[model samples]
Target: MKFHNKKKKSSRGRAKWHALMTIIAVLMVVGTGCSVGFGQNSRKNWEKNIAQETVQVEGLEGEYTLLFLTDTHVVIKDSEVSAQEAEDQESRYPMFVNAEGVPAEEQFPEWIQYANEKKVDAVLLGGDIIDSPSEANLQWLKEQLEALDMPYLYINGNHDWTYPWEYMTDMGRERYLPLLEPFMQGNTAFQRLNLGGLVILGIDDSTNQVDAQALDRYREALMDNRPVIVMAHVPFMTQSALSKAVEAWNSPVVIGAGNFGGIYPNEESEKFISLTTAADSPVELVLAGHVHFYDRDVIEGEKNVPQVVGAAGYQGNAVLIHITGTEN
Candidate 1:
């Protein structure tokens, strides 16, 4: 589907000016002796917010590093839209800024620069890279990701595809598939990338449910006999993450959990969870982001799976994961 692009030059200029003014205003506040905590939020100090962790696989043959980020919530309005739609996009800008009032549009490039500098094996974007499926946002996301020196996998987050005015339904997701297909590699629902000995599996659970087709692909990935790491938008239900999500959002926002005023898994989602958490499952770790906070929990089974939920990228949050295998 073709997206409307009108008044591109003027719209982009306005967006840039608006962002510049925001940064100036924040600097003014900090200069006026306001205790807005600019120390940690300084633009040059954004790297201080990145969190790092390392995982070891018993039979793995080499070491690979990945840069994981999510929930960037980038908002850009470079194409023609309704006044109300433009206002909606503008309203979301402040919601995703760093403490220093730097927007995701600014922080995202920095994150990519870090990945390129570190030369990580790959970049895992857990989803919600854009605030919505606006043409401007999608174009910006594509440009940033394509410029990366290494391969990157991007999954869908709830906000990436749905417009603020539309209800999130299966049909709604299908409507945007063509626009999103270019970044999804081959499949918009599920994707897999093999890094020689370690495999990274990306599944789109942005709608809080996994497609039956995705479950089939997941099973195939499991048969590869390589250590696998699953990445998705929503985190699975674990007691710790559940409690934290409730505390933070005052609702159940996870997947595979029974109905409790939150999203309940459908048959496919239930089966997907069963396969991932099975006693003999080969999933070594799960990485996700949606709760907008950092958390780690072990999904209980005969063998527990470690799950790491990353915080929001708009706040300059990122996770540097080091995967190392036994030496040959």
Candidate 2:
């Protein structure tokens, strides 16, 4: 559970040289371009362009502050993510980058400082704690979280369990999850937290399948009298792919060419939709990430329950929720 700042070791060490050579031999492309695939903006620009909205909900005794951070994708080696022999992986993103000032990557720590200074009740790490599931990267994450004063609820995004150069499968996760567990505060995949008289369900679904376990967990989390907040890395199927909304996105290309945005659909997805929209469903709000954008929507069928999907804040921005009239 120890975190360390990376020592300023020489870059020309034989070990570093060998690793660099291996990366070059594997992909044959040197991806260290000045371009940030996920382009960014200055804090000043975010302040001018970003607008914070407040929403009210039912069932609470005191105010609760929840900060949501998404798509951090901490690149451990400073090369393009996953050392993927390329740098333009972010070029296809749909966001209108204000690529003139400080990149979001450099501003991430300030977001943490803001949260701590505000003394938020808890922090929700939406997904992608690291761009690659490297031991070094996870250690880096552990170091970062050590300074926070509130609880951290989290889940894994596509980038979390993948190696720097390959796809992530359940098989890959079996080996990766153990290494990541000790560095995080709560369940990185599936777990429930009761704080401030609110039941928060954190579902970790890497694959698209809406499995029975997730639905069952969702159902059980609603058993309490307190309002419930459901969180996940990817969102549940609720709408068609975004077109105009695409401008707010950061990784549309990795998601798909035309497929700018939308949750994965399946049989389990129906059950999830039906239950969340049901009159008896205790969910008060749904918080999700992965699109690397800021958005808020009201559920079409559930009394217009609010759902706020956060941007990949680790790359740039974050959303904070203030709930009053709730007690833990």
Taken over the whole model, the C-alpha lDDT of each candidate is: 0.85, 0.62
Candidate 1 displacement at residue 172 in angstroms: 2.7
lDDT of 1 by residue, 1-328 (tens): 1233556766898999999999998888788645445643444445538788888898888899999999999998654987877888878888988887787888898888889999999999998988888888888988998789999888888888888777486676678766887898868789888898999999988878885668888998898888999998999888888888999999878885566677888988888788888887889999999899999898766678999999999998999999997555
Off by over 4 Å in 2: 1-51, 78-105, 183-187, 238-241, 244-264, 326-328
Backbone clash total for model 1 is 0
| Strongest candidate by lDDT | 1
Tens digits of per-residue lDDT, candidate 2, 119-221, equal: 9888888777566676556666777788788787767777777764466756676787667666443345566767867777777665654445567767767
Give the local distance difference test score of model 1. 0.85
Q: Tell me how many clashing residue pairs each candidate has.
A: 0, 9
Please report the TM-score between candidate 1 and the true structure. 0.84
Candidate 2 residue pairs in backbone clash: 60-325, 60-326, 61-325, 61-326, 62-325, 62-326, 82-164, 292-312, 293-311
Question: How does candidate 2 fare on TM-score?
Answer: 0.70
